[model samples]
Target chain A: MDLVNQILNSFILFKAAFLILNLILIVFLLVVLQQVFAMSSVITDAFDSGIIRTVAIALLVISVSLFLTALVIL
Target chain B: MPDLFIAPLNKQEEPKQSDDLLMSKSSLPLTELPSNLHLFSSFVANPRGIHFQNQDSDEKVLLFIKRDLITNIVWVGISILFIFIPIIIAVASPFMGNFLNFLPGRHIFFYLLLYYLFVGTYVFVNFFTWYFNIALVTNKRIIDVDFSSLVYKNVAATKLSLVQDVSYDQVGIVRSIFDYGDILVQTAGTLDNFHFEAAPSPENAVHIIQDLIGKEARNGLS
Candidate 1:
């Protein structure tokens, strides 16, 4: 019973660490994506601005939402 | 002593195209941009509407093209499969209930949703790469912009006067029906060959380049 309890505690700790790491990674990706979008907009002014902006904003929102979902589920 | 022989050889080697004839005949006018071709969604047929990076004050964009939309069918099919596979698995879950005991119910669904979102993001990024990478033709140069991968991009340009030969090949039934083909531009000396692959109306593109080259020749002669 004591061994099972110790294993359960270890699993919980691992799960929490995994969630935090995943959240950090998602945040990093969000920053990288935003920078990429900005650079693209600057380089290709002839591209459809509306579409680029829309997609960028959508990605940002979805990523934040995913982060929050992770917080809740984890 | 060899002057008489040189004159005849020079005359035979020279093309018979006169500057006056070339100038008198207007080049083919740029046509309306075609549709149902995702690759050429924003192909600038005329010099009036578009601009490019590092464009000179006087240089004009004659044509901008991307690969044929048909080329994307395979990846698009795969994306469709990714979207449907989860639903298919869910539908079959009843039969494999025992098999999936390891996946707790609501949490498994959430995890699957997260996975789909990541895939969706990946697909979005690739779509931008496909849509933005293009081949451009300007009055003075032929330019190829390749978004080869997520982290790498390459742009190559050569002057129209340097282009030695231009040819096109339209193979396969679909390409023939749609009049889309690959335009290959061979440059003089050691420059890399420029390939405008799966370009729509390649014959017209070739004519445009030929007219530009003829104009350049005329300018040089005068």
Candidate 2:
């Protein structure tokens, strides 16, 4: 029974690590998105600004989705 | 108007500046440029797609440059290595046996997915840094835009009239082979000088800037 409890505790740690990593990534990506928006506003490249912003937004969305999935399914 | 004032014969005549375009500006366009120029090129002339903050309506961007693409090879290579790590681990998993025994086997796939997503973020951030860190030579001013990271974004500018001298140097075998170097502009007064680092074709950049400063000085705009 003690061995089983130890194994279960390790599994909890593994899951917790994934959740914490994903949460940190989500925050970092939010900052990135904001930076993209602010920088694009400062120097607008008619051809590439929109595309860069879209890419940033896409990354943020993917990150949030992954975080939610990890919370529910990890 | 010719100077009516006579110079003393005892005093030596001051030598005038020899106007020379050290590097040929023949290829640089003052007006229209080829429409096919790629947006990602490290050097671009007459960039129609570029517009910056506080730019005058009449201002025309004469030149645009960024650090050479070769400079990004390190990050590109690392990102590629990161992309393949999950595959390598999955293939080696059987040999390691019980390495991930604490966690359910199927859940490992989700973790791998999360890892790749984080790697994607790394790539995105690096790309953004490269894309935005650039310098521009407009008809009226010089702008150096430096976007290093989320916490640091620097945009430095000085009027063409304030530019006193322009020079570029290509050192090191790599810089020579890649044909990109630093272009330094000395400005007068209290304004800070501009340094365009890893600017592609620094020679031509210097020539273009010299021409602008010369024109501005001739018109007594400074």
Number of the top lDDT candidate? 2
TM-score of each: 0.75, 0.86
* DockQ of all candidate complexes: 0.28, 0.68
Chain A TM-score values for every predicted structure, listed in order: 0.60, 0.89
Off by over 4 Å in 1: A1-50, B1-28, B32-42, B47-49, B101-106
Candidate 1, TM-score vs. the true structure? Answer: 0.75
Q: List the residue pairs that clash in candidate 1.
A: none
Residues B22-121, candidate 2, lDDT per residue (tens digit)?
1244645433333233546788777667788999998878788888888888999999999998788778878999476556865787788788888989
Winning model by DockQ = 2
| Residues forming the 10-long window of minimal summed lDDT in candidate 1 chain B | B18-27
For each of the candidates, give the backbone clash count. Answer: 0, 0
For candidate 2, give the docking quality class from DockQ: medium
